[model samples]
Target: MAAKLVTRCSLLMQVLVFFLAVVPDAFALPLNRLKSLTVIEEVNRRGPYLGLITVIESEENAFFATGAFKPHKTHPFVDLSGRRFRVGKIHGEKVIYVRCGVGMVNAAAATQQILDLFDIKGIIHFGIAGNANDSLSIGDVIIPKQFAHTGIWDWVNLYSTTNLSDVVHLDIASYNVPKGEGTNLLGHIGHRNEEFYSELGKPNTAQPLFWAETSKHWLHLAANLENLNSTMNLSDVVHLDIASYNVPKGEGTNLLGHIGHRNAEFYSELGKPNTAQPLFWAETSKHWLHLAANLETSLSNGFPVIVFRGLSDLAGGQSGENAISKFGPLAALNTAKAVVQFIKTLQ
Candidate 1:
């Protein structure tokens, strides 16, 4: 009887082993089939926002933007991943307003977090920035159609030559850097394209990207907001024609050829249109604004992005002392108004 029992136990053990190997799902826990939950999901009362309003910091520009934001009745603020996102409405459109700290990394991280944790249909990043376009003035706002990352550059050795197309080699002699052995420490600053790598079969291959364009559909919507400019209290010098100030040489042109084309070769090489001519201000691009806009467009996959920048300072190009302090609030307010107006136009 003992021998018979031992044989029966061995046979049962073999059957169990075969069943476990062949049909593993039969004994699997239900937990394995559960969907992964995001932090916003765990909170139980968060997003599904219509848009996200991102700014660099909360001191000046952000202050104005938040003031315009009307919070939701139930659960107005949601704190997650070290960010205090204001769940609110801008111009009746549901939005998540957050200050994205500062710099590229901060902006990128905050943008990604909001996207991952919420259902955002679009983004509107607005703030005051230094003005590179002379045609625009402090307190004036601009909405660019596209953006580029111009900060990433190659500092070539002094006197070194580059023959690459679309590369800008700007000599830095006027800045007055240290002179080492009768030569500046670094040569010209080479403006190169933003480097990108493919995630597919050619991960090692580098691709050059110049501009990140904003959504044309969003841009078309923004066009309706142009009438808002008529109501803004802008500077008298706003969109002032620099050519008018130039002394004409009597050949139906100014003495300096075109005041805006002082660096015509530079603009030509970069493929930027000259803004010296009348009504050519539309082609001008703001620097810091471009960076923020490009960042938003690059990180977003499902949502459209629009950027608004109010010219606060001349980016060190002003004739007198920097006017950022005096004009920052006005610039910030102007952008806030534009953002609100833009939001109303969106569906």
Candidate 2:
């Protein structure tokens, strides 16, 4: 049995605060706004176990979460954080692995603990999400430049509002930088030799700009950085969340994400046992992907945030009783391979 002993969040926060007090521009955003992921008793002596680890956040649905892990050693659990990482070399790189327990909050919380505790070069978030774009098939991979979380919207500061135009604009840009910001050790989203991921290096075009409304930072989504402030409308919409269409990246991969927020009853409430896909499962990455990367970046003051996700189903786009069971593994394994390939080039 794992011991109940674990370090408290307050102590971690205090340690972070002590650092923040010494350095003014140390953090990218306010520390209080971020979620507190629990990490327990530190492991003594840093060696192979302390290096960057590939994280597998697979456990959301019935499909993408299950797969076999190769021979590896199980390290002591970061008990309070509820994680016991598997450590071993992967393709010549010393690495660790953790299957983020299902859902958004669990994903975020666990990611924070890893980001906070590990001596990571970067993070590769590999898992299955519902595919909403029609052009892509069951196994195609997607590396999003900017991620759109379905659960959040910027309302008109009104109570009990449901109308779209009245109060609806995407908030909190979940970003993935393939190439590390400057000389940082993190790998590019795609192969460094590939020109596709390099565009993000061009600030005006690739690197995004943001608008802050009080504490909440909202990413401006338009291709034209100048229009980041443009009003939100179906006409001015940079992304179409639900339904099917040709994503700007063209047919092969729709990297611009339309991720959904769902809970236990998300399927039944939407009449999901039916033929059509539930649009809500678009991007399953919870809020933690960026937080983990960002906090690490802040601590290192340079490492880039690279968020990678893949699709197992169309969030119910198909009509097979066993589709998720079939394709989930395909997407998860493919996504994992893609991440490992990317990681191979990091050093």
The most accurate candidate by TM-score is 1
> How much lDDT does candidate 1 score?
0.57
The per-model lDDT (C-alpha) reads: 0.57, 0.38
Model 1 residue-pair collision total: 1
Q: Write the per-residue lDDT of candidate 1 for residues 38-74, one digit (tens) a residue.
A: 3345333444575555555523354454466777776
List candidate 2 segments past 4 Å from native: 1-80, 154-303, 320-322
- Tens digits of per-residue lDDT, candidate 2, 168-270, equal 3332122335533433322222111101112224433333222101111111111122232122110111223332433332345434345243211101111
Q: Where's the lowest-lDDT run of ten residues in candidate 1? A: 261-270
- Find the candidate with the highest lDDT and give its number: 1
